[model samples]
Target: MNQHKKGLVVWIGIVLLLLAGALLAGPGDRVETVQETMRDAVLHNVNRISLLGLKEVNPGLISAFLVTIILLIAAALIRIFAVPRFRYIPGKLQLLLEQAVGLFDNMARGASPHRFRFVGAYIFAAGAFIFVGTLFELLGIQVVTVGGHPITLPAPLSDVNAAIALGTLSYLVILSGGVAANGVKGVGKTLKEFSLPISMSFRLFGALLSGLLVTELVYYYVNLSFVLPVVVGVLFTLLHAVIQTYVLTMLTSMYYGEVSEPSPPKPKKKKQASSPAEHA
Candidate 1:
């Protein structure tokens, strides 16, 4: 084999040996089922919600709140430091931000040519939230459970409630677009698709839940947990993040376009010359 091929083979063999050793030496622990792995435990009970009133402060909400704060701080820092430092040639971060803005703006325009102006920013914001929130779990930030067990915080969308909120919120944003573009007619048009929020919410929940469950299942087994957890978790998380972000953004943009579309004017009747008999 060539030198490069030999080096690659050596690395592969080393990795395989390490994996084998880890797997063989691992303690054989019983695996947790999908249901058990997927459930979010309470960190601590907070004030009453008054609506549902379960009492446990949702870890999903806490995670989402942290993500939101991170996003806001990043935005603020970018505006203060990055924006001011941007030069004529454009640095990496500035270029990336500009490109992202341009991409979402283009998608908004393509989805709703006439009414995109009303909802473009909303689409961009929603896309950002979904993408960031989906990958938040990879940060491995730990939160103490009410039972005193510390666990890595799960992504917000992995929680059904948070998924539902995001879905409903996206639908509302689309509705607002409709209202802005067509007023009462827009409202009526948006309300026509009553099942939208539920579907959206469930879809987000299902996709994220699938990824979470898969990763958890991988980690639940000692043998599989060796080097496989990292691979499985990352692949699932990245896959879900990209897929869900695109799906939600596309759906929102399409629906917004549909509701905001202006009705075509009816053709006017031709004012023909009077018939000869009528004139006579």
Candidate 2:
């Protein structure tokens, strides 16, 4: 079945990503002589490697920040115009976004109406993931300006860890909300909701992360070995964009449907009537 195949592919991708992250970020993966010499001359002051520390001295961090801002603005525009209205889709961008929105709406209808509120959060989280991925790639390109040297990024958390954390938390919230909204009757159904978000979010994060890591790994190994970087880079970036958009909108609709369920109506307020004499 298609669903089974999809699940298999996702799990395989997750495994590959874990291996890649461990290979690249493990304790023994220290900078070699060339990288150390370059850093010594250009970035000797860089002592610590925390997120905040990197941001203060690294141009890549500034670039990442700017790119994040741009992504947020684009996401805002998409949310405001494209998503809610379901407007026309002529260009490739609009067409792509329309497909994602359609999938998300289907998910929303299946979840609770109140859960629909979480569409915004999913959009934000997904967009953030994509922006981060693209920013890393762009920074890699920028490193070429300095004599085609390799540049390292300040990895916030391992891809596997992030995937697990993001997926588990998102699912728990969705499952809990759906269960509470449906009262005690649909406990089983609500419990089932947990896996959907978890799997969806994890699959997406793993795919994107794997794409990024693979690109960097390939470039590292085959920079001038007749392995065309442009083609490979473009391919991975394209895949990343498409996958991120799909995941973002799909999760949004899933959460939206969960939270969008209508609550039971309360008794109408009895408006005090005017005196009968005044009416007569």
Scored by lDDT, the top model is 1
TM-score of each: 0.81, 0.48
lDDT of each structure? Answer: 0.79, 0.53
Error of 1 at 197 (Å): 1.0
Stretches > 4 Å off in candidate 1:
1-21, 24-35, 39-55, 266-280
Worst 10 residues of 2 by lDDT: 41-50
Report how far off residue 153 is in candidate 1 (Å): 0.6
For model 2, what is the alpha-carbon lDDT of residue 50? 32
